[model samples]
Target: MYLTIPVLVLLVDLSFEKEYLSWKLLTTKVVFGQAVQLRCHLPKQNCCHNYTRSWRGGPDYTLLTLNEKSSNYTKYIEYLDTESRTSVLTIKSFSESEVDIIYQCSYGFSSYEAILQLTRHRYEFHPTESVPVSLSFNGTHMYAKISLEKVFPKPQCYGNTNEKDITKESLKVISKRNGIFYKSMIDFNYMIDPQHCFGLVTITCTVGTSRITIAEQNTSCRKNGSTFHGKHLAQRDSVASNSHDEESNIVGKVLIVLCFHFFNGL
Candidate 1:
């Protein structure tokens, strides 16, 4: 028998183009031990001239220039030059059991945040399951939405607004939802205490044993306070083709190999 594992294709375009600077973000859902490429492109039209670019880690961290200690980030970070129109950062392969990582790009005085999440393919042959999720934020209080894509059996979703970790009772059921690319999205306006949460503000969405988090926001009390307001987002028209299904088949074979270890007690 064959197992049909749904794939979620998110066109995450945190890649922005403005009068000063612009960047291109990675949209592919990356697997373990795979190098990911990200680019910061500067168009000659309205971009700031001679703007120095640097990469930083986490929702809260000084410029990468201050790092004297060695970590995973240093091993993965590549070169950046102001003379070139584009700066490429090629992240080295990550371990399957490794935790999720966030990367921030800064140019001049503007900063953009993006997080890279790790995923595991759950086989239906087993009694357990997993939910595929994507987490993102707009910095603004508006459009602070959490997307629960590629959920099997239409799993129930609960959201909680917390600092660091989610609380048990804060996760309220998210009812207002829409479907996209053969998947589902849940949108809500859960308020955030800007001053209290600060760089630690987060929203955790729970679906059974799986959960996704929205973090590294630069919210403050002076700007929007605790009012998290946002309009509903529409679904995308472009549907994924047969290529993704073929990719699933490749992942299935890898899953079989992983399961073999469990049975053999490796």
Candidate 2:
């Protein structure tokens, strides 16, 4: 279920050709939970000052920075190829939320971008124990969010009923990349089953191309003071148990406002 996004290529004119970098392809694509390889060919330069190697994504955020001759990368592996005059980036396994992003390589004065898109497989999309995804209620409405590097194409959420039909809803993508790497946030309004009496609620979260996570937790809606709890999800045996009646959408709409106050005493 991997989906590819079209990439935009930008050109720059250099009077001196020493700072040019070339890409093997316009875009680099990989399936979710898989590895990928990227090559950034470098041009010979006569400058005395050394050029730095770094990876850029989402505005000016730098995902990784290192000397081309470094021994090893912490998360992924990289190597400087002297034979082909190229810099390589290799991801052994991609489990991060931010996979759909524009990744660029910078070596001193030369920089170029290669679109990176990761898609889920047809069957599985849930974040494993290593990566956690949550869908919980914040009193008034249910919000779903995941901690990822980026949410490309953005994720769409939906609700399911006993009849097996699902309805799609809008999902919002939020990012917290200050000037370095991004810790993206994606939230959305959770739709509920109209027949909340006995029918189950299957909450499925999907990014642009494929699924992310799907769960069927027994949650009850509140008419007045109901609370929605979405602890971190587990791939298997994901059960949030409560014997109380399930709350309806009407009852969970009670509104309340508060202020931030520093407590003088415990």
Candidate 3:
């Protein structure tokens, strides 16, 4: 039953400078109610013939050998092939309590370690909090902007306008929390009908099993409204500063002329 459900398995190769050993860590991305597998193996090398392999994990660093198969919430399996040996650790269900567990596969004196970092893949926007989205029309194009908070492992965001995919520019790590969660921003623009700059705008972002979407009919384009929200708002202050600079220069010139006349009088 556990193998029947859809799961995403990601293989990450951890390369080392030592030619005597070749190993990799495989991570399976899973949701809260799902199971996850952490696999460690020596690939394409018969490096395990001389060294004994074992696994250690959990808060107490409990050592697991070939005979130990089940722990509190974990299951361990080790098998051998013609060219390699593999050790797999499976968590029955993933949750907050199962996080921060360090799993390691030890081969003689060398070992590879991986920690369980829980990632929330299917997050829902709370009703009290508003999704940060803004829309504006600049005569020829309509621009939509959104900011997503607390996304981990980065994300791929796609923007669509009227059922067609548009290009999205992203800014990563505008903010971070707890050294893991990050804030991401995306800007999307599309050429609109000159007569009607309104259309359906949608943005969807995915990270692991987590996906977020925002779709709406862009009705913010109206005549005589602010066409650009992020444009310069201090033009008047800039002109005033320039005028003050000119007046200060004229005063300095007059003071210099007065000092010259005073020294001549003396």
Candidate 4:
């Protein structure tokens, strides 16, 4: 007896782009050495005939089909339902070179493009250490400032002394290049009556697991009060939470290998 194997092909309607079609590629701040998954689909359309569904991008013009796993760190999966079809692209381990680049998913003759961007501290092109921390005083209040550029996720800033909480505000500027510009400031009145204490003002911002900190010690305060130390201020402003208006844009660049190999006899 002879056995036959069926090739699992995706039956995509060429007209899937019409009448409530939804196709998008998305991901969060892709950290180096972490896994990332991007989902793509066209809503409200189902076909009975198998067409071509593939992904095009990465090093060596990666062309991946449904259920295919690339030699690199990429893989593709496809799903079908009664009303729509879904395709997902997953990178086993995201890297720095893959940041800020375009990847495409093609169904039949239609395709959509998407780009993945790194958080502030992950992009080697614009190192996070390049930004400087600022500290100053106005004779009445001690002020500390921390600024970061190309930050994708919203940042939380804190100003603290003696490990106690203080007043701090954060701001994020909208931009289209890599991410957003984040700046935070902390203010403390060191001239309280009957007690004057000032020692260290530490400024810090955290986005996901990445954090940046700045501290200035021995600030001018009366020598009679308790010394203020550095601590993360648990505070965020409305500006930082609402500054992301647009997604990062992708440009064609060097190849970061992503291959799609379809499962045989599907």
Candidate 5:
């Protein structure tokens, strides 16, 4: 009877650990300008228990959605306590602003959290040349492509100034001056433009080590004699060069140490 009791307790503990450690969200990178579903899965044994899920924006804990007090919140936000143990947060339309927020999933006794961010392509236009430039990343390097409406009198162009790590590969200029508009794409190191002052300049920036990506597009035009000359800029979305693997490793190690101390106390 004593041996059987120990075995039963061991099995129960293992079952809890398996369910507590299950993967909640499956996707690593969420694209900008799309809706996302955040899910939480409890272990089979715990799936029948009541759980609460909530989300907060940034480290400031600005509450975005909560499972409590439905009448106090907007209609777009809904709570589904479908089963006792599992809960899900459905974001109808996910935007770049929401990417940096932290999502927390909790039960009566345990909780888990993750950071959200966005990824996508970007573009920028230089008005002096009346050309549109786009940027993209190829895992290890960055590049750019330039498209033009009319052949400029000059052959060289300059990209908007950005931080150092976000440097672009050699600029590849595509001149289709004969066409009404030209299109091109290129690779470049990740960069964050801090001087984004206008509303229409399309710029995409992702937070470091977080799953947040912000994309903005802007345009400005001036009347030149009888014609209107303008520039259109779109920032492409790129993963922040910064990664959370190191932080995750540190967190995992700390959890292991806490578990050891907990068992020792027991």
Candidate 6:
């Protein structure tokens, strides 16, 4: 008797919903001279089908970029395919003033929005100008010191206008070692929050006619339950030491090979 095996057939159900824009609503912080890009991805091909995309400014509907128009500002928008299913909006250059406006990406019936925030200030220097600044850190604290040769009755901290407003009182003076100078010290207490996972700290210094600003970021690694310190000297020293040891080991291996070859030849 001959027996045949029956093939089992299975029906699979596959259905996809229209794509929606998923993006963070937080503002982006960028340097004055650098460029920034705002991106958005459609949920699925069905949502992008027969749909038009455009960029607008707030409720005023000020058109920044449109699929139909091509100009200097709109040049950043690139159409990827014949269906126009994928697109990217890029800012080739950024300035301090652009931080005040809000940028929005809209597709058919859905939209995503973001604002630009400048967290640091741009410094322009002249041939005769000088900026005095120093940074120091202890195990638990960080300190910034500044000295200005000239004195001003109304010294102001100048930086990105989009940042929070800073007052004159925030500038604290430590001491004046010499009669023809002035000094200021800023004390920063360091703390880690595992729950928040990430944090950003910005420091700004202003003197009689010069101003400077710095930023530091901290992030936590969940797998190891440790914080990533971008500014810690100890971490930097360890990294340097490891690199040096690796190089030394590599050199020792090369030297051993060379000595073996030399003795064999002799």
Question: In terms of lDDT, which candidate is strongest?
Answer: 3
Give the per-residue lDDT digits (tens) of candidate 4, residues 1-266.
12322222223334436333334544545554566666667443444135466666654456644434444444434444434466666765555555567777765556777665444544322224544355666655554434344444555555566575553332222233443333333332333233646566665556555666644445655654223321112223444444442211121121221222233323
Best by TM-score: 4
Q: Please provide, for model 2 over 34-118, each residue's C-alpha lDDT reduced to its tens digit, 9 standing for 90 to 100.
A: 6656777776773222667765553334565465433336445556777666777775555444455677777776778766544
Residue-wise lDDT of candidate 3 within 1-266, one digit each (tens)?
A: 66644332211223341323333334444554455556666533546466666667755668755423444434444544434455555655544445667777666655777676554543211211264355666667656656665455456666666666664332222334524445665556666654544556666666655566643445555553343432344666688899999999999999999999999999
Task: Sum up the clashes in candidate 4.
Answer: 9
Candidate order by lDDT, decreasing, is 3, 2, 4, 6, 1, 5
TM-score of each: 0.29, 0.34, 0.41, 0.42, 0.34, 0.34
Instruction: Report every candidate's CA lDDT.
Output: 0.45, 0.51, 0.54, 0.48, 0.42, 0.46
RMSD to native, candidate 6: 29.3
C-alpha RMSD values across all candidates? 35.9, 25.6, 21.9, 34.7, 37.6, 29.3
lDDT of 1 at 15: 30
Model 2 alpha-carbon drift over 4 Å, by segment? 1-20, 23-38, 43-68, 80-85, 91-153, 166-200, 217-266
Per-residue lDDT of candidate 5, residues 91-204 (tens digit):
544443455457666554555666753322221122223323444544323344333332212223333333322223333344443332233232233333223322232223
TM-score for candidate 1, please give it: 0.29
Positional deviation of 125 in candidate 1, in angstroms? 18
Clashing pairs in 2: 98-149, 98-150, 125-212, 220-246, 220-247, 221-246, 221-247, 223-251
User: Where does candidate 5 stray beyond 4 Å?
Assistant: 1-23, 26-29, 49-53, 56-59, 68-85, 117-266
